[model samples]
Target: MIGIIDYGMGNLFSVSKALERIGVPYIISDSPEELNKTKGVILPGVGAFKDAMARLQEKELDQFIHQYVDSGRPLLGICLGMQLLFEESEENGRFQGLGLLKGRIVRIPDRDQNGERLKVPHMGWNKLHFHQEAPVLHDIQDGYVYFVHSYYADGIDEQALLASAEYGVQVPAVVGQGNVSGMQFHPEKSSATGMQLLTNFAKAMERSEELL
Candidate 1:
């Protein structure tokens, strides 16, 4: 089973529904103890970085995540949840993140290098370009995925970058380091490409279980 952290800010319904559609059993809760029992965890969010971090801290799940990752359990973050995995975010002033990965979150450029006005909240489908292989990306090819965000991950280490999408900037689309991973796009809403990602993640978790 997978534990979906419900810290009062995530798109819990959509994420849970996606998991169910993929036939991946999951439990939604705020308790780390309950989450720790699962083989994998998913952190899904859709809101401000500061607010989300405050909620996670209030539940003490922030520390729980660290402990869980230290045990080598897979943890995937979606959208805003992805940003929280980094060191900090400039979404609304400088706020500390979970620091599970090397990077910071910054707003998408509103203007291009040529001084052309670009759209913010890069909302729509974008093609993914794979940089490295990851278990969750197995059997997945370069395809379009749904993206809707105003900020993107920056200053990321090359080793942790799995995939990226082009907006005004080269947005970090899919990133992972060992058991920790994140997706800037909403796989639950990305059609075939999205479903494949969810399916791949479930399969990866199952494979890990079988090894034990």
Candidate 2:
């Protein structure tokens, strides 16, 4: 089973529905004890970085997540949740993140190379370019995924970057380091490609269990 950490910021309904459609069992909980029962955990969010981090810290979910990851269990952070995995963010003044991955989140530049003003919140479908191999990316070569964020992860360790998408600028679309993974796009809403990615994650969880 997978635990969906609900700290009152994520798109819980959509994420849980997506997991259900994929036939993966999941439990949504704010209690760390309940989350500890699952083999894998997913941190999903759709809100401001500062607010989300504050909520996580308020509930002590941040510390629980660290302990969870340290156990070598797989943890996937989606969208805003992905940003929280970094060191800090500049969304609304500098704020500390979960520090799961070495990097910082910065706002996407407003202008392109041609000095043309680009829209913020880079909403819509974008093609993904693989940077390296990962179990969560199994059977997914390269394809488009839905993205809807204004900030992007930067100064990331090259070894931890798994995939990216271009939108006048390179966006870190998929990222993972060992048992921790993150998706900037909404895989739960990316159609077949999204479903496939979620399926791959479920399969990875299964594999991890088999080994244990």
Candidate 3:
């Protein structure tokens, strides 16, 4: 079964629904034992980084998550959950993050060298463009997906970025490295395009297990 870590402050319903629709066996739980038994884990959230971290810590799932990451099992983080995979975020007074990935979160640049107004919270339907080809993106077409965030990860290693979207500036839409993956957009709400993304992730998890 796939494990959805329900620490607190997650878009739990939509994410759970997406997994169900994809016919993936899954459970949402804060229990470390249940989480450890799962074939793969997903961290989904639609809230502040600080608050989510607090809930994970309170539930004592933080260390478990770290151990799982080191196990080389796939662990996907969605939206704000993706931000928490990093070292720190500047969302509210330089709050620290999970440091699962080597990076820091910061606000997107509003102006390019050309000096144009780039809006924050880059919401609405935007195209997902792959940074470089990877198996996780297999059969995944470049299409529109929903986004609802003001800040995006910056100065991250280019190798970790999987896809980007235009929002006055190129925004990181999908990110992955080794066994960890993330999405800045809400794949659960993006309809066929979104469902396809989740399905793709499910397939990726399945493939990882076969190799083991």
Best by lDDT: 2
Error of 1 at 202 (Å): 1.3
Candidate 2's C-alpha runs over 4 A off are none
After the best TM-score superposition of candidate 3, give how far the Cα of residue 146 lies from its true spot, in angstroms: 0.6
Give the candidate order by descending TM-score: 2, 1, 3
- Residue pairs in steric clash, candidate 3? 121-149, 121-150
- Number of clashes recorded per candidate: 0, 0, 2
Per-candidate TM-scores read 0.97, 0.98, 0.94
- Local error of candidate 1 at residue 29 (angstroms): 0.4
Cα-based RMSD of candidate 1? 1.1
lDDT of 1 at 40: 90
Give the alpha carbon lDDT tens digit for every residue of 9-105 in model 3: 8979999999899899899999999899987899998877778888989998889989998887899899998888888898777887888777888
Better of 1 and 2 by TM-score: 2
Off by over 4 Å in 3: 110-114
Give lDDT per model, in order.
Answer: 0.92, 0.93, 0.85
Looking at candidate 3, the ten consecutive residues that score lowest on lDDT are 134-143
Q: Locate the minimum summed-lDDT window of 10 residues in model 2.
A: 135-144
